[model samples]
Target: MDVKRWLEGVQPRPATATFIAEALSRKAGVKFSLEDVGMGGVITPATLELGLEYTAAAPKVGSQLLGLTRRDLAEDPLAVEATVVPSAWTQPLLTWLLSRPEPLPAGNGIQVNVGDSDIRAVRMTTQLFMKLDFQFGGGHARAALAQYYVRDVSPLLEGKFTEAVGRELFSAAAEVAQLLGWTAYDLGRHGLAQRYMIQALRLAQAAGDRMLGGRLLGNMSHQANYLGSFQQSIQLARAAQEGSKGIASSTTMASFLAMEARAHAGNGDDRACSYAFREAEKIFDSRNIGDDPEWISYFDEAELAGEGAHCFRDLRKPLIAQEFAGHCLELTDPFYARTLSFIRLVQAATYVHQSEPCQAVALATEAIEIAGSLKSKRYLRYVSDLCTDLAEYRETHDVGRFLEMVATKYPAL
Candidate 1:
């Protein structure tokens, strides 16, 4: 019954493990799935391999999405243990790129008609939730978003609508599902995030929203890069670019290219990273915001700078990283706490790379202070990584004080 023992790798009873995982997740500001804590038992390879496929048909995508959401609502343990299969990435990317968008099939269930007003309402609600996600962390209103999706949005998918309304409805639903995935990713629930993203991509495809589909693939690329699957990340980004070619607005293309640059930087391919970064900058500079889809309105200069900062930080170009990070911090909205925290961490890491332990510790402490207000595991990990970077300087007075402060604030770290 000692939680400390469970933290030390002692496996508890399944039911006990579930409670412990939830408790630990809350305490640590990171989601700990049953499998993450070693409570998952005898997971079949088949069950482990769910949610990887990129289906060709719209109906199949809808069915899969419903199943995913239902299992998520029920808190099914297997849903938490879903594996991130490396081989799964390539085929799906290929399928999505090679296939054309499928038309929305006729809805069968209820006679209820989903009109443009309903679609507009869904978009407005999703935009509000997206703003919440930006201002607060994903853990803030993720449950509410999920509940809304299941309760309100899911039914609309089954209702009768004209071809135009159906397309708009599916696109709006995809946006919600994509937000669900983004929230899960922010909470460090990568498996669940992957599942939602896959479904979102399918829904976007069904809606014939090529730009949105590309954006979903870019989301997958971002997640894959975060999970250290750099090659997969690169492929996913490229797939996004290829799949949306000629159609994607400049901003969306730039975002996809930025994701590719991130993957290249993570893989230590400096030349490739530089090439991609240049392309992203060029496209972004020429972007006509008026021509972009509503969903891609978030990828502005600040976001692009953040991505550049991350790329340079990973590539060990501290000076350039610091430059980009500074611009990102200046341009980013104060309401975007999580993003600012991340950019601050990137700046802190640049200081560490410059061998300025005192400056690094000061900046990192500030980042941790900002992160303290959020519930993002990824932000915590960023703080932890800064701590790791400062490990070599632990003997220094500034770093020692910083470490003590971190211990006081986040004992789990």
Candidate 2:
């Protein structure tokens, strides 16, 4: 169980790997080995053993756990290609952790006073950043969050508090960490996003929040799909579905199903994608607002339409893509500027697929203009992809003008 030794043996070590090694080795006394642990490569319930058995009186980082195999410890752990959904081995562990009556202390050297009001303040501030991310872009809000997470929130985990307050505080911190992961994804920092996601999941587990954990898994699925890691995407999406089980609201399940549909579309399984999409729609239609969690309230019909647009676009159905994209545009709020820009980019790309360069140029022009007012790397990424596709039709006057405008206005896009 020489964790540091195993970590040092990794070839072409990732920065994430190094950080995990240093943090775990220094923060806790427990040691884990690949051969000694089950399901060690994943962030599962078995990982809880690391923090739960520490009785040496030294404080720890709440109860957030880290799980990685010996091989994962010795190689590139983030290689998510061909990754499969894990068996529900963590369920019993989750139950045990949730059944605990006492709140775990924070990591050694973390000394800060925390109260319920402090947790509420963090939640309110987090909501503001979340709104900014929805409207302005992740680039506008991520730096402030990164600093707050490290300097302000991290210490609060170890702060003195009653058990109820501690759990609530952990939950709040977990939500903020998830937002940080999302913003990182929006900023095109995929690797950093993955790390944040892993940490967020661990925090959720510590907080005994199953729905939040499922949402984080779903986010990972979304990122994997965008990166063309379709297998992992499906695996993660299904994992979200199964892990949440009785805990996830119907809308949340619909979101997970929608994500799985996108992964299936990426794999060219049209029938499977269609089936999942229909099932998602059915579940969404049956939603009861009172039973829904606030975290999943955003997955309404408009969001589902956006997913449909992406699915049809990937399936080479330009007409269907435009139909869904148009629906998304109609339902999207003007305040959701980033989402609107993204859907417009999809619509413009659909026009390109239809061989209508003039329409594509016009739509792309509007999307680029919207993006100009935002600081989202994700939005710019869509614009850049559209530019690459439009290059084929650059001989057309509209396309030519589009290219020139893009070069002039967004030189780095």
Candidate 3:
């Protein structure tokens, strides 16, 4: 349909808006209802293209995505579908980005003296968004952070600051970028999330924050695994392990090892997965209070246990997976509604593997209810997976009802 070009030339009619929304749905990997498109509002193609372009982000911006602004991005008027195929900003873009020299200002421009307070404010905002992301889901937080990043943080990078201050600002900005990537991933925007994470890694590197950079790599690995690129996931995890060898705390190391374990489990390498799990536990037990980086402080025993359950589930060890998943559910806080929902889904998957269809359906129902309250496509993805697992048992009355219930609750699924 060449939506970008079409919108440039014609005002969007109701039928055209509906058509565009449907087109976005087809691209997003999920269905979208006609009501999703805003009628009577002018469709902004440039903004839409920008959002779509982010799905496959370039390593280095020739210029900060020409003609974007806080207001234009803040509302995300393009209503771009989430499922578009990533463009040039995928693997090749990452390769070129890594091979390129570090970013340096081209020439002296307007010097807006940046200070510690400015950097601190950015970090604080990042922390707040991180908490929000945990509670609600990436679907809600990603755009908010992106808007702020473009409006507030991006300029600081190009502004005049001392080398030390610049590094600090970059570090803070990198954290924001990392969260944006993570939230994007949570919303099922894998390619876009990858680009954001890679950019975050570069910013972290410029800040000399090896530990943060390593975490970013681990995050990338996590996404790669989700995308079914297990070998690439393993390589990225190993990079995280090596990159943060001395600088990272026990909790961070545990996270890296757990990520590697997941990739191994995905590959059916139970033995290798077990090895990584053991090392993760050993390092995790060795941690002292407050030793972990703020970024990885969430990788506590509960988080590790959840990962353990995930690994064992992938290995088809239903009993062991259930045990670990149960522990995670118990230890996780209620305020982390989205995390709790995911853990519940893991528990449900374990039940399905055990042939406890009734229990699985019940747990899945609970997860869906949780998902219903949040805007998280990732949580819904879990629900969709649960439906897939239950497909074999469709003849059972309970399973059939469960599937029907899910379809009713999430038509987009």
Best by TM-score: 1
Q: On TM-score, who's better, 2 or 3?
A: 3
What does the lDDT read for residue 286 in candidate 1?
98
Query: Number of clashing residue pairs in every model?
Result: 0, 2, 2
Candidate 1's C-alpha runs over 4 A off are: 1-50
lDDT of 2 by residue, 163-262 (tens): 6677677778878878877886787766556655666766666676777878887897898888888887888888888877887888988999999999
Ordering by TM-score: 1, 3, 2
User: Can you tell me which runs of candidate 2 are displaced by over 4 Å?
Assistant: 1-113
Residue runs of model 3 more than 4 Å from their true location after superposition: 1-111
Better by TM-score, candidate 3 or 1:
1
Candidate 1: tens digits of C-alpha lDDT, residues 80-116: 5565666766766776688775667667667477888
lDDT of 1 at 235: 92
Cα deviation at 250, candidate 3, in Å, is 1.1
TM-score of each: 0.86, 0.76, 0.79
lDDT over C-alpha atoms for residue 129 of model 3: 92
Clashing pairs in 1: none
Clashing pairs for predicted structure model 2, backbone only = 60-106, 60-107
Which run of 10 residues does model 2 get worst, by summed lDDT?
A: 65-74
lDDT of 3 at 322: 89
